[model samples]
Target: MRSVSRRSLLRGGALGVAAVTVAGCAEQEPRQAQRLAAEPPDPETMLIRQLIAGKERTVALYSSADSDRLTPFRQRHEAHLAELRRRLPRESGSASPASSAGAQADPSASPSGAATAGSQISVRDLRDMERKAAALRPRQLDGVSPALAQLIASIGACEAAHALALSRSL
Candidate 1:
């Protein structure tokens, strides 16, 4: 084995540190890119995007329902989604509500296990989801445009009405 000088040891140690630092930075770059790609640029637009996503998920839920009454309700969500998409800024790219909403519209997207396998969703579950969604609208109003705020309120009212209708159906 060759004798190792102190300078050589120091150089190897520095190179190892440099290599680790570079590797760490390289790993972080992709994660940063992914985060930027996944997150909406503005909070207001993010809120609208979330609402559109929720409506799409709701539509998916209603679509999977066995009842004829749910069909009109599902259609209403589709109309809401269309209107929401129309309100989204053109600068939003393909990140517009329509595309993003569809991407997240799976029934499994619901947090409450409301759309489980082999089991039909209960009317109570629908009511609960609508009620929760409607409750979220007031909180979403502060940072949005007046027209968007009005639309959110209207949609919340509609969801509240849906909750009542679902309650009656149960």
Candidate 2:
């Protein structure tokens, strides 16, 4: 019977471990990738998406109205939407929510409508929306980046102004 040296046995064991480790890692690579792909988006991305949806709704509401007075308001909302879109991470699929909604004469006519038909979006409705959006801004500030927080604050201020302006228009 051949005698195996301790060093030789140790070396063989080490090699076996190395081979198993390499094989295990190779098997796990795809699983790790799948897990990563399945993970939910980050907080900032989610907030940005929510903001985009709200702005889209607001723009649609403004579009539904025929008032010349609301054009600038709609334009401002559009600009805000553009900025929000720019901030969205590219890897997060930066597709804007159904931009076609912005063109509809009445938001109620669109699927997943913001308002009921025959109850046209009045100045009071817009004012209430602006007020609510502004009030929610501070809560949204937490857990966001400084730049995003600043942008949100500015937007809130603008919304507050919009609310005030809409109030005066009535």
Candidate 3:
């Protein structure tokens, strides 16, 4: 007859926990989010990729730390990436972003945060971005497709929320 001792059971439970921890770490693809795929020469595609990279980094940071406070903000960032990519021109869908007047002239843009300008944004920084997005609306809506206006408005609202969340988190 086999006897199950208390110490043996405790050791088995500990082993189970260790196995789960190792499995969790093994399943993580930490660098996949940083790998922006090479696409054709499309500014819109490049911009979308930039947005995705930024959002993914933020999400990863929050996820690794198990922070629930950032859930909504991370979701909004993901939405902006998905929505903007869906609305971009197909030809420019795979191209790299261009640093020219043509790309600059795009009134319809995404919220990429202060990271785009080579700095980290504070709570106030997010609020400023929201305000800027709202101001852009009047001019951006001028003679453009209704779709564009709606998209910008959606992003504006989300950006505002991000500002509020940042303030609370900080």
Candidate 4:
């Protein structure tokens, strides 16, 4: 067999290297795409997160009040919070209350931060919050799973009752 020429051997080696480089780049493109593309959270997950935040807020509101009469209501909200937490997906479960509720100040706090630690949120304010939350549940049910829908409906009913009871108690 004729001896291989140096120029031909070099050209062959360069072509092989080029082929490997292209193949390696092609394999990496899909991986890079996967790393960059994040899927959005599901609607039910979002609803559950919001419900957890709202329940936390309601619990905090209840805690701020000195009335012993509101203890049972607060306990119910705590239960709701537990259930909502149970339903949260594993990946998102680590999200903190502040992150979920955003960076805003507490709902009962005054803009000037003048509301002292002993200041109590009014019954009317709680009632209005309950009414608004109750009204929002129906809208929230549209895209959630059946189990979640049922839970939301039950919570909404309780909130409506709370509003009515607060009105009578006032």
Candidate 5:
């Protein structure tokens, strides 16, 4: 029998294991964009849409805003909007259902859906929105795949961090 060096055998075994591990982790992502399209937006989904629209307006508002401190937070809100859209179906991603809901909630006033938790949303609104997102962090891990859950948690944390930074700037 031919003698194999112990170091050579170990190196070969390690390479084979590494290849198998990499291959195992390479599952194709499902076309969830299409899947979410066929379903009606749930209440949770509707809430997200509201937030997206609010962020969209925030980005637009802040871009023209005079406050130097708000510029980056506005940009972050824009990025956050894009990330939030990635989590939803392409079609409903553009919906502004919160405006309608807000209108319904108060007949005399316009649906200022962008209004944050505070009396009047200025830069402070970003902080409020981030606080709300942080509350959703734990739910990210519930019933979802670990990878997706982590993505959600990270995004939520990112929003929370943005809010913190914005608060300081204001």
Candidate 6:
């Protein structure tokens, strides 16, 4: 075998270093992307998102109900959603967690359309959902800011009132 020249050896060494550098940079890209993707949402934000999703589900349940009877109730949920969004940080993306939950929850709310196809909503179903949502609020108070806690409490009160109102309809 012919012996390698000093110039050729140096050229190969330079190429190897360049390749290693490029590889290192490429590896870091995915790690950086993973870090961004896995970042946890703040507690307050998470709670707010959950509440928004619940309200959206409530509104969806009313969609196929009698407009004259449920329209006022649906409007209250809309107002709650608006208030929750207003409390969120401005930097928070426009894509609310409600949008994602709405897609899944709306379809399942009236699975057979048996309940919703009728002129009236199932008051029992609405009351159950409202009760569950209200129950969740107390748990959500943990780790939230004082301001957020107050807001959550108010929302919970509204949910409780909604459940009572629904009970009256039955």
Whose TM-score is greatest here? 2
lDDT of 3 at 11: 100
Q: Write the per-residue lDDT of candidate 4 for residues 1-170, one digit (tens) a residue.
A: 99999999999999999999999999999997676446656767776777777777778877887689999888988988888778888875435666567423323222123333356787777777778777777887887889999998998898899889988988
Q: Largest lDDT belongs to which candidate? A: 2
Candidate 2 per-residue C-alpha lDDT over 90-142 given as tens digits, one digit per residue, 9 for 90 to 100:
87765557632333222111323355333467777788778887888888899
Worst 10 residues of 6 by lDDT: 103-112
Tens-digit lDDT string for candidate 1 (125-146): 7778887877777887897889
Candidate 3 TM-score, true structure as reference: 0.43
As a TM-score, model 2 comes out at: 0.68
Greater lDDT among 1 and 5 belongs to 1
Candidate 4, residue 26: lDDT: 99
Off by over 4 Å in 2: 1-37, 99-119
Which regions of candidate 6 are displaced past 4 Å? 1-34, 94-121
lDDT of each: 0.75, 0.77, 0.51, 0.75, 0.57, 0.71
**CA RMSD of all predictions:** 8.5, 10.3, 15.3, 8.7, 15.1, 6.9
lDDT of 3 by residue, 1-170 (tens): 99999999999999999999988876664444334334344533444444444434444433443446556665676666566656666644422233122332232232344333334444444444445545554554454467766775676676656656566755
Show pairs that collide, candidate 6. none
Model 5 superposed RMSD (Cα): 15.1
44-119: candidate 5 lDDT, tens digit per residue? 4554555555555556555544577667766766776677666655555354444323311211111234663333
By TM-score: ranked, best first: 2, 1, 4, 6, 5, 3
lDDT of 5 at 96: 44
Write the number of the candidate with greater TM-score, choosing between 2 and 4: 2
lDDT of 6 by residue, 1-170 (tens): 99999999999999999999999999999998798659866766666666666566567668756567878878988888788878876654634753436323322223232454344557787777677777767877888899989987887798789889988988
- Arrange candidates, best lDDT first: 2, 4, 1, 6, 5, 3
- The model with the greater TM-score, 1 or 6, is 1
